[model samples]
Target: MAICIPPLDASTESSAERKLHEALRSGLSDDFLVLHSVKWIAKPRGAGPRDGEVDFLICHPKHGLLVVEVKGGGVILDYAMRRFASIDRHGDEHEITNPFEQAMRGKFAILEKLKESPFWQKLGLGRIPLGHAAFFPDVDGVGGLVGPDAPLDIIGGRQDIALISQWVDRAFTYWAGPGGQGALSELGAGGVATVQRILARVSTTRPLVSARLVQEEQTRIELTERQAAILDLLSRQRRVMVAGGAGTGKTLIAREKAARAAEEGLKTLLVCYNRGLADHLREQCEGIEGLDVATFHQLCKRWIDKAKSELGRDLMAEARRDYPGGTEFDHHQPIALAFAIDAFGPNYDAIIVDEAQDFGDEFWLPIEMMLSDHADGLLYVFLDENQNIYGRSAAIPIKGEPMLLDKNCRNTTTIHAAAYRYYRGVRIEAPEITGTKIELLTAPDIDRQARAISALVTRLVAVEGVAPHDIGVLLCDGRARSSFERALAAMTIPKSSRWGHLEGYGQGSITVDSVAKFKGLERAIIILWGLDASDPVVDRETLYVGMSRAKSMLYLCGTVAACGRVLDAGVA
Candidate 1:
């Protein structure tokens, strides 16, 4: 049986085309390759450019090339008017293009396109035989439909379906003419493979990193506009808590709200739990005056330092004296910030907290106290409970019901499918952007995994034309991140490659970091490494956060057993 490019399916609109496709697939030898619905645009030497489509482009090592046009229903040809039509089962006639002309034009156009390839000249395939034919599965006899261009031998009818190979061979012979057998034989198996490669290269294409990013940004803007309605609805509310899953634009909405508040002459502070996210917010909100961005601990430390410098009060020392048991940042910093807020009084008119689920109950008091008027000051908190990897259970101080963001606008549908398996939350509507599937690359150990990753990175950058900075390598096992980094550093990478953390992401280097550090952030392409099923730290939440970071493409690299465990964990 012949191989089909797209594989014959019921989705084909024309019943006649489907019938012909099946007949060719079953009747042709294994050497033949049938490509259906092949469309192309061509510019002949003296004529203007024209668009053409061949219903079936048949290729064989021994038979050369043939373009076949299939007309399922009754075909009507008017030689005087040079017009053609098709009669349906209901006896209704629909005007149609001349199948013979279309097939011939498609054949020439495809031949011209193939000739443009340097490979054709190198292989000396210019003299290879090429032909065109028309097939009418519903018509009883097309032998009388011969003309100057439509020869009787090149026109097929219902009875010819059983002997499609012989009919095609006859068409080839008619086009090749006498003594053209040498030309047909010239396109040996090797030459035919070269032609296939040329055709495939010309036909297959993918968007580059820049174009994909632009498309994704446009989609994000549209989705953000849809989420803006929620802000408009809550414009008058003093305190609001917005809850959503990852990629729901919580951080984006928070930034917009903070900017608007600052524009109103209100001092606004935008804070999140992740330092990388905080740095990103700071960079994005740089020129906006009266708005400050920081992580919760960073804000606490900044306030304590200011109090000690200007007010002659060492709040950090006092907090250390009072709370001496737990970690300084966790226990003492919030206390110090509360003391500093008391000393300086409310300094901001509004405060926006992103990644609110990462903040503990103790952190909200000082946060609320930062508002000039606690009763009427604006406080918006965005949180996704599922991403509380640090396991903080804070009862947010917002009064009214939290608004729910159900749509995910960040990750593509393919990445969403893998990530949402571990998500335990309200249903999140997947994004409309359907992207490439998650690729799994397995090795036996970290050394082999590093080599595979290096090759993949090179291909993505050198061959696939992806920017180095657009790619990221995230370690699923945070503890093994350094080990993976060392292994990768030992490998021979491209000279253009620069390895750094998420802080240096998109700055002309490929960044590598733990999935936890990259929380609340995303990259266009993500390569997740060090996925060990035996590691206790690599749990469902870790997988969810790591896999969700990819916006366009995702490659999961690990040992076979590790990858198998991940797939078995419902991520398949």
Candidate 2:
């Protein structure tokens, strides 16, 4: 089987080109390298500048190079007027350049481009055989269609499709005389690979993170508009729960609900469990009047501070003394907020919660109490059970069945496939965008992993144009987080590099956080590090949250055995 650049099924509007491409791909031997639709611009010496496309360029070690110009449909040649036309299936005739002339021009243009490369001269490739041909797949026979330039041997018809190899050999022999050039035979596989490298140089520029974010935002807007009907259907209901898998725009819908309530002149509070998510929600609702955004803990702190005098005691001191250091925030905050709200009365006309799955069973009471009218005020909750990393089985207190959002508007198809392995709920239709594959970087230990991550971040920021703030380093194990931080700090930082934790996010630095803490938040690029084959905490739920946090690019870095375990687990 011949190797075809762009493949035979690649998108093309020309049916004739596709037909000839298929013939060349299927009929040629494995030694042949066929490039279809090669665009070039050249200004040969003693000739006007030529800029056009070559329908097909075939290269072989034994036969040298051949440029083929293919014309589909009915071919009409006007010898007297020196004009050419092709009639389509609709019987509409369109004048076109002579295929023979086009083939010759393309052949020379490519030759000229190749000669400009020093490697071409180093290999003495100029002495190799070169030829051109015109193929008309719709024409039955072109044996009698001879002209000064369009010789019978140089023109191919539909009948030649089956004997394409023979036809190509004949054309090469015609250009090389009775005996082929010995130089052609000497251009072996290595020479062919070098030629391909010269013709199609390895060059690429990744889309800037800012630009990609804009494109993704636009797609979300379109998908979100499609979900507007769901919101409209439940507009009259005062209390509703929206359930969805990750990337299903649950947070987007929650934001919209809060904004709508504010638009209606009702004071609204948009709250979530994660501080990162709360910060994001606040940014999204910045200018809206009558709307307030805060993390559940932040909301608790606010009310607790306001009701301190009525309680007649330092609640923070009491909680610190009664509970363990970190337990005080989880155990005493919500209870204190409830008492504060009861004394101060309800603070808002409507309340909205996002990432509701992260809240404890008792957390709902204080959330509901914030509404001015507990029975009639709007209370909207958005939750994804699969993302419940906190191990909370708390269900929303809403009475009716939750509305389901099954279409994922965020994350590329590749990311979705990897993340959905651990998902066990209603099916989520993958996003339409088929992004690049997830990259897995394996290292021997934490130090090497940190170095690899640093190198990757450098390339992404300095070479690929990705913004530092748009990239995140999410640690899978809590213990590895400090090791990575120490490794990064001890290294000689690049002049352009800046690293920070979630606290310094958006401060023009690459943010780092634990996967559990970074839940409900996303970044354009995520580097999930510190997976251990022996670590029990690196389970399905943890992997799902860490991998899905990447909106575009994902890199999994860990020990070889650990990375192997993830792949063996079928998360790829």
Q: TM-score per candidate, in order? A: 0.61, 0.59
lDDT of each candidate versus the true structure: 0.78, 0.75
Per-residue lDDT of model 2, residues 446-488, tens digit only: 7888888888887887888776778888888766678889987
Which pairs clash in the backbone of model 2?
A: none
* Residue 105 Cα positional deviation in candidate 2, in Å, after optimal superposition: 78
lDDT of 1 by residue, 230-272 (tens): 6654455677889888788887788877876664446789998
User: Model 2: residues >4 Å from true position, as ranges?
Assistant: 1-220, 224-226, 309-327, 533-538, 570-572
Q: Report backbone clashes per prediction.
A: 0, 0
Off by over 4 Å in 1: 1-220, 224-226, 534-538
State the TM-score for model 1.
Answer: 0.61
Model 1: weakest 10-residue lDDT segment is 203-212
lDDT score of residue 6 within candidate 1: 70
